[model samples]
Target: MTATLHTAPVTIPDTTDQRVVRRRLGPGHRIRFSFWFGPALALAIWSIGSATGLIKPAILSAPWDVVVAFQDQWVNHDLLGNIVASLQRSLVGLTLGVVTGAVLAVISGLSRFGESLIDGPIQIKRSVPTLAIIPLFIAWFGIGEEMKVITIALISLVPIYIHTHNGLRGIDGKYAELAETIGINHGEFIRHVVLPGALPGFLLGMRFAVTSSLLGLVVVEHYNAVAGIGYMITLAEQYGQTDVIVVGLVIYGIFGYCADSAVRFTGRRVLAWRQTLEG
Candidate 1:
C-alpha cells in the first residue's frame, strides 16, 4: 500500500486596486515629456502642416517666420522695453493684490467680529465679476496707468482672499485643542500652527492671483495709451502683423506657465510635510 499526501493550494488576497496603478515617472521625466517632447511634437506638426499648405502661412506664420519676426522686432522695435513695462505693471499690481488680500483674509479668518464686518461685503463683491466693473473703473480712473494697475489688482484680490481665508478657517480643531493644552499663546499658535497649516491654500491663492494679474494687465492694456506687450499686440492687430501677434501671445503663454510653475515649486518646498494625492 502507498500512502498519498494531499496539499491545499493557497490564495493571495489582493490589497491594491490594479486599476489605480499608474506609471510613476520622475520629475525630470515629467518635465521632458511636457516641455521637450510636447513642444517638439507640436513644432513638427506645425512645420509639416505649413510646408504642405494645410495651414495658411498668412493666418498662422511658420516657425521660422516667427523667429525672423522676433529678431526683426528685437532689433528695430522696443521689444525689451515692452517686456519690462508689462513686467513692472504685473509686479506692482500683484504686490498690491497680495498685500490687500492677505490683510483682509487674516482679519476675517481670525475673529468672528472681523468676519461679520468684512466677510459679507467681500462675498458680495466676489459674486460680481470684476470684468463687469471695467466700465465703472474706466469712468473712475479714466483709462490711465492707475486704471490699468488697479484693474490687475482688483482682479487678483478675490482669489487670494477666498483661498487664504478658507485656509485659515479650515485649520484642524484638534490642533487648536492641542495648542490650548500645551499653553501656546494666540500669536505663537498662529505663527507655528495655523499659518503653516493654511500655507497650501495661501500658495494656491497666489497661483490664481498671478494668472488673474496677467490677464487683467493684458485686458487693461487693450484700452487706450499702453506701452506693454499687450499694446504691441494691439498695434500688430491693426497693422495685420500676425507673426508679431503670435510671438506676443507665445510670450504671454510662456510667462504664465513659468509663473505657475514657480508657485508650485514654492508650495512643494514650503509644504514639505504634505503629500500630494494622485487621483
Candidate 2:
C-alpha cells in the first residue's frame, strides 16, 4: 500500500473591489507632450467638421478662419495691448482679493467674535450672485475701471475666504493643545501651526480665485469696456464676426488654462509634503 499525503486546500481572497483598473486613457494616465492635447484634438475635429461642411462658419468658424482672424487681430487690431490691459486688471484685482481674503479668513477663523462679525455678511454675500451685484456696483462706482476691478475683487475674495477659513477651523484641536503644552507663544503658534495647516486650503482657494479674476474681468469688459479681449468679443458679436469671436474664445481659454496651471504648479511646490492623488 502506497502512503498518500493530504494537502490543505488554499482559498483565494476576493480582490475585485481592491484592484486598480488601469485604462489606455484616464486622469492617472499623464500624456507627456509639449503641445496641448485637448486643443489639438479639438482643432483636428473642427478642421474635419469644417472641411466636411458639417459645421457652419457662421456658427463656428473653421480652424483656418480662426487662425486668419488671430493674425488679423494680432497685426491690425492690437491683440497684445488688449491682452496686457486684461491681464493688468486681472492681476490687480486678484492681488487685492487674495490678500483681503487671507487676512479676513485668519481673523474670522481664529476668534468666535471675529467670525460672528465677518462670517454672516460674507455668507449672505456668497448666496447672492456677484454678477447680480453688477448693476448696484455700477450705480455706486459707475462704469469705470474702479467698478471693473472692484467687481473682480468682490467675486474673487469670497471663495478664498470660505476655503481658507474652513482649512483653519479644520486644524486638529490636539495640535493646539500640544502647542500650548510646549509653551509656544500665540504668534509663534500661529506662524508654525496655523499657517501651515491652512496653506493647502489657501492654495486651493487661490486656484478658484485666479479663475474668478478672469471671469470678473470678462464680465466687466463685456458690459462696458473700450479695451480687453472681452471688449473684442463684444465687438465681434456686434459685427457678427464668427471667426473673431472664436479667436477671443480661444484667447480666454488659453489665459484661464495658463493661469490655473500656474496656480497648480505653485501649489505642488508649496504642498510637496502632502500625499495626494494629484501628485
Candidate 3:
C-alpha cells in the first residue's frame, strides 16, 4: 500500500477594509458620468416645479429668469469689474494668510518656546467668529479694502495654523529615530520628513481657508462693499430681484465648487503616493 501524503491548509489574511464594508457598497466600478447626476436631477426638479407653477419666483427664481438676470448683469452692470475686484482682494488675502499661517505653524510645531508664546493667543482667537470681529476690524481699519483684506486673511489663517501644526506634530516618531540613526542633518531630515508629513493637513486646511476667504468676502461686501458678488446680492435684495439674487448665489456656489475641485485635483497629484479612500 502507498503511504498517503497529508497537506497543511493555508490561511489567507483578510485584506478588505472593514470601514468601507460598514458603508453601503456602490457599483464595484467607478461611474464615469455619475458626477453630473445630482446637479442634473436638482435642475430638472427646479425647472419642472417652476413650469408647473408650484415654485414661484418670489421664493426661488426660474432657471430661465436666472439666466436672463445673468445676461442683464453682463450687459448693464460692471460684472467683470466686480469679479476682478473680488478676485484681487481674495487672492491677496489668501496669499498673505497661507504664507503667514504656514510660517507660524512651522515655528510653533517645531519648538516648545514658540508654541508656548503663539498657541494660546491663536486658541483664544479660534473661539471668535470672523463675523464677530468685523466691527472691531472696522473700528481699527475703517470700512475699506484694508479692513476687508485683513478680515479675510484673519479668517483664513486659523484653520491653516491648526491643521498644519497638528500635521507636523503628528508625524511618526519612528521616522525621526531612523533619521537620527542615519545621522541625517536636522534641516535635511525636516526637508524629507516634516513638510511631507504635514502636507495632507496643509491641503485640507487650504480647502477650508479658501471657503473662509469667500465667507469673509461676503460679510465685508454686504457691509459697505462697492463691488463683488456679495455687493450684487445686496443690490438685488434691496430691489427685490429674486432672479438676480439667485444669480449671485449661483456665482458663489460655482466659485466654491471650482476652488474645492482645483485644490482636490492638485492635492491628488501632489500626494499621489497616498492610498486614500477617494484616491
Best by lDDT: 2
Better of 1 and 3 by TM-score: 3
| Alpha-carbon lDDT of model 3 | 0.88
- How high is each candidate's TM-score? 0.85, 0.86, 0.88
Among all candidates shown, the one with the greatest TM-score: 3
Q: What TM-score does prediction 3 earn?
A: 0.88
- Model 1 is weakest, by summed lDDT over 10 consecutive residues, at 23-32
Instruction: Give candidate 1 misplaced runs (Cα > 4 Å).
Output: 1-41, 277-279
Write one digit per residue (lDDT tens) for candidate 3, span 1-279: 999999999877565664355333643433565556877899999999999999987899999999999999999998888788888888889888989999999999999999999999989999988789889989999998999999989999998999999999999999999999999999998999999999999999999999998888778888788898888989889989999989888887777778877898899799978866665
Name the lDDT value of residue 178 in candidate 1.
96
lDDT (0 to 1) per candidate: 0.85, 0.89, 0.88
Candidate 3 lDDT at 42 equals 91
Model 2: weakest 10-residue lDDT segment is: 17-26
- What is candidate 2's lDDT per residue for 42-88, written digit by digit as tens? 88898999999999887799989999999999999889988898999
Instruction: lDDT winner between 2 and 3, please give it.
Output: 2
- List pairs with backbone clashes in candidate 1: none
Candidate 2, residue 154: Cα displacement in angstroms equals: 0.3
Query: Residue 264's C-alpha lDDT in candidate 2?
Result: 84
